[model samples]
Target: MTQAQQLREAILAAPLETSNFGETPQPGTLYLPLSHLKALRLDAHVVVGGRGVGKSFWTAALQSEPLRRLLGLAASELKGMEVHAGFSIAEHIDNYPNADVFDAFLAEGGDPYDLWRAVVLRWIARQAGKIIPHDSWPHTVAWLKQNPEDVARLMQQPRNWKGLILFDALDRTSADWRRMDSIVQGLLRTTLWLKAYPGLYAKVFLRDDQAERTVFNFTDASKLTATKAELKWARHDLHGLLWQRLINAPDTHGEILRDICRSTQQENVWHVAPEMKSESDPQRKAFETLAGPWMGRDKRRGVPYTWSVSHLSDGRGQTSPRSFLAAIRQAAEDSLERYPSHEYALHYESIKRGIQKASEIRVQEMAEDYPWVPKTLAVLSGMNVPMDFDIVREKWENAPAGALEGNPTRLPAQHIDRGWDGVREDLQRLGLLETKKDGRIDMPDLYRVGFGLGRKGGVKPKG
Candidate 1:
């Protein structure tokens, strides 16, 4: 095999699956974006971000002792802090209530606030070795509600260690938005309730849509909202993460890639230099080593370093690391198969094809999250964006009666009662569609290509 083929092999070994990738990311695959530092701090009560932006990743990473120690290098407050999952995708009936327990409790006219408080109280009870009701969730909640003084004494008692409680994947707690909103609001109230104790901290991971709801309408909601941190990845941060993973590939592959990128190894993990973490000449030169200088025969085609990411951004000007890394991996595979003899591991043409592959994967993730999204967006598949809203609304209205039917068991179509306008707003909020200054609708190439939408002078969707 030639050098390009070998490099492709090295790139293939990096983690590409983002959505359903295992909860605990291996230590070697870790990369910290400067923008995410505040979100990882103990005091940030609410962390919000788009899908595939590392909310779930951090939820699991914070639980690992080794990962916490590594993250501590950047945020010293995380060192030696006890982390526990109060409510997460990884459901533990003993630690917290599951969907069924929540459903049953709420069905019986139980308050979600008391249930969440019970979750924290149980964690503290275990730590303090005080026996309460261990039989079931309802039993625990009943005990807490029945004994106010006992709960207050346990909460106010000082301890030598500080604890961090995490809550994520809250959408799984309920299907309907109204119920989900109530549950979320209750959790926030409980998070505010946690503030009274100096030794305990609460961190809640929420999606942007969830944050925009009435969950924060309750008393003292601003206390948690004030400490909100958004999880974002900058352009250089994406490249930094790419090199971080590239340099840590298995065995000889790691040695070769690390040598090309010129990364630093410390504590048995590779890191991109500070200069490489920005759009410096060094960062450009590093990517050029693998994909070459220009995206085409000359500079007229634009630089591969910037073109690759710019093409993958959504309409909101946000590009998830999941999209970027997935595109690179696909590009490497395409280059190896179609242009093994090419001078670089990632050919310009192959990079374009990588965007197509990444878009397809992203659409699949959307389907899993909101099954109604694919069906609704399918109507505009062949149409071009940046067109007038009336035309799009006409298309939506002209579709079959069953086309827009929503699944209430999942996240139902947002604001369906308001008709096509509501759907338009929902899509815009999701970074899938944007309204131009003239009120024309726009879709980003990240979703446009996969969803089979057209844009003038843009990457064409597959026939």
Candidate 2:
């Protein structure tokens, strides 16, 4: 076999892992996008980002002592801190309230602030060997609220350790948007409440929409909001993350990647050779080593590095690390299967197919979080975007009542009662849809490709 064939097979065999939802991230795979550095700060109480932008990933990573130590190198303040989970979707249901229980608590006029404090109190109680009402949120809340003086005394009596409690996937706490918002608000309120104590802190991972909503309506919501840090991926960060994973591949694949990648003393800190000046520049060289820079043999088709990322961006020009990795993984699989004899491991066409795959995964994730969004957007799959607002509204208006079920995520029925315009506004707010300067509707490539929508001059994927 030729060197190209060896490279192709190695690429085919390389492990391209994505989705940090349920598993503990390996220390080697933890590439901190510079934007996430703020999130690792002990004082950054609230971290916000869109889906697949490391909310759950950071949540899980912070819990691991090894990862925390590694992370501390960048955020020195995180050193010597104990980490706990106040709430998480990946955690056992018993650890936090489920949907029915949360609703019931709200029905009884129970405040989410009290519920969140109960969660904190339980964590404190566990540390102090004081057993509280662990079985019931109501009982726990009542106990925590009734014993404010005791709770204050207990908090003040803390030992030699400083600690951080993490909250992630707040959407799981309730299906109704209002309820979830309230729960998140309460959690933030609790975060502020914890601030009075010197050694204790809370970190919340919230969705962008959740952070932008009325969840921060309280008097000092600004305190938590002031410390908010966004989890964004720069173009260079995505490339750095890709090489980091590629060089860490197992066996012969790892050997080949390490030979090409420049390394730091840290076990998996992979980078292009020192000749590459910028973070984005190394990515181009590293990717060129695999796919020879261009999408094809010529420049007209596009550069894989630019085209791949440009095609995955949301309406706001944000491209997530998850989608970028997914696209590359799918590109490799497609190239090996369809263009085994191609000069590079990944074919340009294969990369386009990868975008489609990434889009599908993104869409599915969106549906899981906002269940009604897919059905709502399905009405316009084949229609070209930048079309008139009235045209889009007509499509939504003509959509059947059964087709318009908007409560799948159990968000409040605010949109269900409102008309198509309201739905349009909500989609825009979520960064799924945007209005062009021409007063027409536009969906971002992050969402458009999976929905089977097409752009006039965009890279087209084969069916």
Candidate 3:
């Protein structure tokens, strides 16, 4: 068997742990299947990624049995650990039957630091199978209010607690945008406060946009950047994931995975047939030469390649393993639905068609929440098209004269500005855009992959 096939066989035969293949999967819901957890062991770090990238999955996977084993904790000893894993107290304050707690605390008008201390103490007490004594809680609250230094001292006392507190969905808070500054301030404060406590670590998952709007002011990039882990996919990681899924899947469908991967390489050749000019582009010639034997294509067609090699080379090829796996899952589902009886014989064309359909589905899903998705995707598709605030503003102004005639309330110019702002926010949230020192927005290599755009300084595709 070929080396690729041998690798595939080895992965298939290995015992699998998780099915999640994304950056931030939902916590307690999706499991992030990554081999890196073996490295993390019992350490704490911030996981940063866009929505649906698999942050929660990674967090949840860390709580899995294999991880606890790595950390030397028995299953029974980790009972209360799950309580510490969730978003801010605001999300779960209602679950606390003591309405008086919020009323009294808010009435006293304490800084967020004090308020968080009270809430956390109460949460911990509750998790330990004991309620905070009603009378003692008030005294503790008063003590916290009177002696902030004492509270800090008490937080330093190392307890036997051996689990992590995961703060997720910070971007999902319903707080007004104007309040973003204070909200982020409170979050960072809580992180710092929690970190001081012994045997307690907090993991705050945030999107890049939310980080900019909230956490950027309080914490320096160097400090937070070291703790930050971006949720992009590496090609080998993608391959491992696919192999794991194929191996663990029912034996009936096992061969299909290998066939699909092999066929995808073939279909890519056909799709980019026109772009393979040997004489005019020697680099293209070399790439084709390397890929030709596997791709089964001898000549360079004028058609452009769908995947960007330069971006992949820079280690930001795909947005996340989630995107790659989502595409595969969708294609597989489509194949089974279309030809259930003989899905094993699924043609390469069917999978390619499924990928196109899946891409549209993914776009539509994101667009539901983000209105400017279509335009942002269009911009990405328009390779060599410079994107800046001025360019975006011009596009809004020059939109066909009749485009905004129907909506009397929505002025074309105003709508254009809104669209630009929305796109910027959405892209930043998705980690597709980053702000430079000069405040100009730049697209990352991961974003270029879907649009077939090259990396910085790479060859631009002909329009």
Minimum summed lDDT over a 10-residue window in model 1 is located at: 14-23
lDDT of 2 by residue, 136-250 (tens): 7788888788888987877888578888899888878787777788888888889999999898999998888788779888887778778789998877778777777776676
Query: Candidate 3 has what TM-score?
Result: 0.58
Candidate 3 per-residue lDDT, tens place, 385-449, comes to 23565665565467655532322211111124466675455455554566666665555443443
Candidates 1 and 3: which is better by lDDT? 1
The TM-score that candidate 2 achieves is 0.94
TM-score of 1: 0.97
Please give the lDDT score at residue 161 for candidate 1. Answer: 85
lDDT per residue as tens, model 1, 174-214: 88888889899999999999998997999999998999989
Best TM-score among the predictions, by candidate number:
1
